[model samples]
Target: MIAKVMRGQDTLGLLRYLYGPGRANEHTDPHLVAAWRALGVPDPGRDPDADLSVLARRLDRFVRPEVRRHVWHCAVRVAPTDRPLTDTEWDHVARKIAAAGGVAPLGDDRGCRWVALRHDGAESHHIHLLATLARQDDTNPDIHNDALRLRDACRALEDALGLRPTSASNNTSAPSPTRGETEKAHRQGLDRPSRAVLERLARRAAVASRTEQEFLDAVRSTGALVRLRETGQGGPAAGYALALPGDTAPDGGPVWFSGTALAPDLSLPRVRDRFAGAPAAPAPLPAAGPWGQAATAVGELSEHWDGAGQGVRAAGAAALGDVLTAAAVAAPSHVRQVLQGADRDWSHAGRPPVGTARAAVAVRMREAARALSAAAPKGQAPVGELAVRQALQALAGAAEQVTAWYRSCSWEPQERSARLAAEALRAAVGGDGAQPTLNFTM
Candidate 1:
């Protein structure tokens, strides 16, 4: 479950909107499932005669006229895959949210007044909670750190209520696409948001390059506009921003997104760490081609994960993404799309949770990535079917390891991504007429 909290000054406006049909007429059967003190608040949705103004006024009656933004609102939403929660279950959830926010404490009659509203028709099961900030005794409730508290409460609720667990509960996933980004992508006829596109490109560059200059060159090679932020005039770049050719802001300037804005690991400093103590290029491959060499290196990476410190494990996960991206770049036309899909999914699966200590790049896996990048044919050199099969098999093994690791940590989003990537790679291997074996033990 996830909770979004907002504050407003207009209690009546919020109440009316909650009870009325939503902007898209998506809200159905809008009615109160729970309210403060079991106060017998009138249900405007069910009771045609019940005035919304009356309920709003009652909720706000204890607040001083000078109290700005005294109306507290929170929306609690369950995962789409979770079973539908009954009104009774929703009431319990709303109460827990209220208590967590310090809006209304359990068993405290004098606590702030609040109401839980439920409506059908949305894709996900959700409830809206509205509360007045002032308590009955004229003291205002403390709402500091409410978001953190609500997050913790929801994690507990998911386990207690047997609901589908989510990565948001532990804040392990990447920053999700905002509503604005979604709408913008829809308007532009793009398959995904620009942020997502840029993030993928940045990851590919970070993995393929051994230095900042090489990283910039790699990004620009993809037809993305690059703007470097230098520490001083004519000095080395401290950070950089990227934008697609046609993506622009309202002022007609380029719509630039900094590396950090995409993900913490994409930040310039973090990207630099990926090449720390690394060779500029990989060692020459033996008679076996780059694809075969990368496959061997990737197959051996699981050993580093076992009995490794957090940093080493994190580096291994990240290096796997590098290898996937490199393979995607070098893959034959027939299997390139599948490899790209795996690369994209593995990007999320490989990211260390925020605040994890930066680790040195996994040397062997990074070398594999560099070799794959270096070996990519400049012309239309025919790619061997056997090489493609071997690469897919190695990628599948790495993804399975990632999935098991995330599952052990109870990180549902990363685990799901890794599992999906593994499935895609295995399917591709099968399509190439190879019965790939993943030997990694969880």
Candidate 2:
């Protein structure tokens, strides 16, 4: 399940969109599944004579005029694989989430006015929750950390209702795509959101380069427009933003995303630390080749995972992400697609726990990344099957170690990512030079 929260000041505008056809004419039979009062509230979708203005005015009646953003909206969606829930079940889910969000508590007559709407169109499984912030008693409801609370409620409901379990809220995970982003991707015929594509390209660029300039150049080489942010008038670059060539904004300009927006570790300061902590000279490349060397290094870390401290383990996890990114860039076309998927999953798995200091163990893994980057084919050079197999075997082991490490920490998000990466790696190995069919959806 996924829940997104949005605050606004326009109740009428929101209601119009909710009851009427969606941006893509996707809303059909948009009826109220639940509301604060079961009997009196006017439902525009269900009643032929009901109007959007009438419904909006009723919801806003309790809200004070001084309250700038009195409208609270939350969208809840179930996983695609989950069984379809009836309108009654959806009403129950909405009530639970609304209570969790402090909008309308169960059995509280003084709670805020809210309604849950479900469409019987393309996206029939999910429902939209709309609530006025002011309660019936003319007091505002406590909404602090409401997003997190709603997430917890969703997790509990998943268990109670026999639905698919989702990852818990974590500061380290990348931000999920917004409704607009998802719609834009669908409109543009993109397989994933633009933010996701940019993040992957940024990760590859960050891992493949050793200097800030090189990072900038590598990012530009991928055809993304780059804008460097400096500290002062003429100071060195402090940060950067990226935008894809054809992806634009409502104002007919590029939609830029900063490095940190992509991921916490991708920030300029954190990226610089990756270079600062490494040895001055490049690590020696063995006669066995880059892939073989990376495999050996990964295997060594996996073997030592049990004895390593939290800092070392966290650093190793991050370093492993670098290895996967570099390898994806160097792999053949058929294998590259799967490697990219593995890299994406592993990215979420590799984030260090908050306050875990950087460790020196990552230096060795960074060396492996450097070697892979250096060994990437210039044109279409053939890669050895043995080398690819060895690398995949070692990566699978490392992913397993990551899975266990996250499981011990009881972090469901990273654990799931590591498990997915391990499965993809194993599948790739079993394919024997053929394209592996792996699900990349989150």
Please give each candidate's TM-score. 0.68, 0.73
Whole-model Cα lDDT of every candidate shown, in order: 0.78, 0.81
Error of 2 at 121 (Å): 9.6
Best-fitting candidate, scored by TM-score = 2
Badly placed stretches (over 4 Å) of model 2 are 1-15, 23-72, 77-95, 102-115, 119-126, 131-145, 154-170, 185-191, 233-235, 249-253, 277-285, 355-361, 374-380, 426-442
2-68: candidate 2 lDDT, tens digit per residue: 7889999999999889888897766767899999988988887878998888889899988887889
Estimate the lDDT of model 2.
0.81
> Residue 117 error for model 1, in Å?
6.2
> What TM-score would you give candidate 2 relative to the actual structure?
0.73
lDDT of 1 by residue, 12-116 (tens): 999989988766555678888999966679988888999998998999889998899999999887754357889999999999999999988888888999999
Pairs in clash, predicted candidate 2: none
In terms of lDDT, the poorest run of 10 residues in model 1 is: 433-442
